[model samples]
Target: MLRLPGFRVASPTTIAEAVAALAEPGARPIAGGTDLLPNLKHRLGAPTVLVQLSRLPLRDVEVRAGALCIGAGAVLADLAEHPLVRAHAPSLARAAGLVAGPTLRNLGTLGGNLHLDTRCRYVNQTPLWREALGGCLKSHGDRCHVVPGGQTCVAALSSDCAPALVALDATLTLHGPAGARTVALADYYCADGTAHTGRAAGELATEIRVPLAPGPRRETYVKWTVRKSIDFPLISIAMRFDLADDAVAAPIVAARVVVGALASTPKLVRKLDALRGQRLDDPATADAIAAQVGAQCKPLPNLPYDADYRRAVLPVHVRRGIAALVAAGENHG
Candidate 1:
């Protein structure tokens, strides 16, 4: 049986205290403990102290001028069902509801999902199993098993909500010993698997702010995993575009296409100018856009799905997300 390392729990009552406690050596902040607890059991993470943020009043959901502010500690289940989220950011709600099962969603938080760790076939194993393989690049022992001769770890980031948030043009608030600084959600993750998030040590993500701007915004998230219920995303896609009206191609004021679960960070597809002012009136153009977005995804053999299958599903998921957005445009947009 896998056993978790002994660790002390540091319960902090405020955001200030939470960041202060996280400044200690071997300390890690845990909210849901859904992902962290399992990592602890596998001995993948062994922090000496767990600085719990449960007591903090960071679960408030507010609607400000042209933006929605969601506290970090807000539960995934609540976020999924919240009226405001369902209205303003249905894609975000869908992404949250799709993470794991109902029980996990009840415990999971938006912050935890944003800061979810990178996962690999070789690294996310029991201690004995990992030791048997001489450890992978993420464990800092040797080369990456996923991509031989690779200079860096290629562990796949399995965060289902990250892509949705990034596509929504969200901003994150992080508090640490150096005080608070806001970062764009797209800029929060690094490509390196070993230290995926660019967040500094002792930092605690406080909230997520999504702008309700450009008017008539349309967004949708779609994911395909090995299992329909609780499994992490194998190929998750979220597409956001601002349309002039419910028309298919209506002038796109802003657009973002993101692919997750295939790389250390959700990839924001470049060369998206083709989507601007171009209506989806022609199927060939839509297919071309999907192909262009899929071309940016870099899938590795780090997850359960075969690399080829993973790659093949990205465009399909993107197409589905766009279709969903088109269908829901009249209602929200």
Candidate 2:
């Protein structure tokens, strides 16, 4: 049986104490332990001490200053059902409900999911399995199995909620010994798979804030995975379109599409200005946008799924997601 390496635990009741504890050498912060514990059992990392943040007061979900503020320690299950989230950020709620499974969602925190480690088929194996393969870029070897001879790790970021949050223009609030700072969720991820996120060492994410939409809005999150439940996405897509009014034929005033489970950072599809002023009810509009996604996205063999298959079906999912969103809007209108 796989076992976690020996480690001491520190439970801090205050955010200040939690930040100070995380500043210690070989210390790691943990809340739900859903993601971190599995990696620990796989011998992926062995922190000397675990700084427990469950007791900290960072589990509130409320509206403040026209933005929905969600604490980092808020449970994923709670977020999935929270009225504020369901009403203001339904795409995020759907994505949260779709993470892992019902049991893991009950135990996982939003912070844990947001900072989930980059995953690769090669690196997520047992220590013995990895050792026999001579290791890969993320597992202490110089080479990358996915890219062969590539210097950088190409592990995929498989967070379901990340792309949805990015599409909603969310911001993250981080606290550290220095102080607190807020960063746009879109700007938070980097290209490097080994250290994909911009969160600095000795820092802790406290909350995430999503700005309230200025006008009518419709959004959806869709993903393709090996299984309907408990499997990470092979292709994840989140789309947000602000409408001119709450009418069945409202034109899109702004649009943002983010695709995840591809690389270290979610790909925000660019050149979407053409989507502006297009009505969601128009079938041609969906076809044009899906074509753009298909052209811009090129899936890698970072996960266990076939890259070519993922690439071929990427646009199909986009077109279907648009259709579903349009149908939902029509029903509500």
Q: Please report how far candidate 2 places residue 155 from its true position, in Å.
A: 0.5
TM-score of 2: 0.98
lDDT of 2 by residue, 108-224 (tens): 889888999999999888998999999888896888889877988879999999999999999999999999999999999998888999888799999999999898888889988
Measured against the true structure, the TM-scores of the candidates, in listed sequence, are 0.95, 0.98
lDDT tens readout by residue for model 1, 1-333:
656789999999988899889999999999998999998898887798999987899999989878899999999999999998988888899899999999999999999998888999888887888888888778848787888888888788898889999999899999988889999998988979989997887999998999875667677788887779999888888878777775655777667888888769898888888767766544665587688876778678899779888778778777766666566546652
C-alpha lDDT of residue 100 in model 1: 96
Which regions of candidate 2 deviate over 4 angstroms?
Answer: 331-333
Candidate 1, position 42, lDDT: 86
Task: Mark the 10 consecutive residues where model 1 has the least summed lDDT.
Answer: 324-333
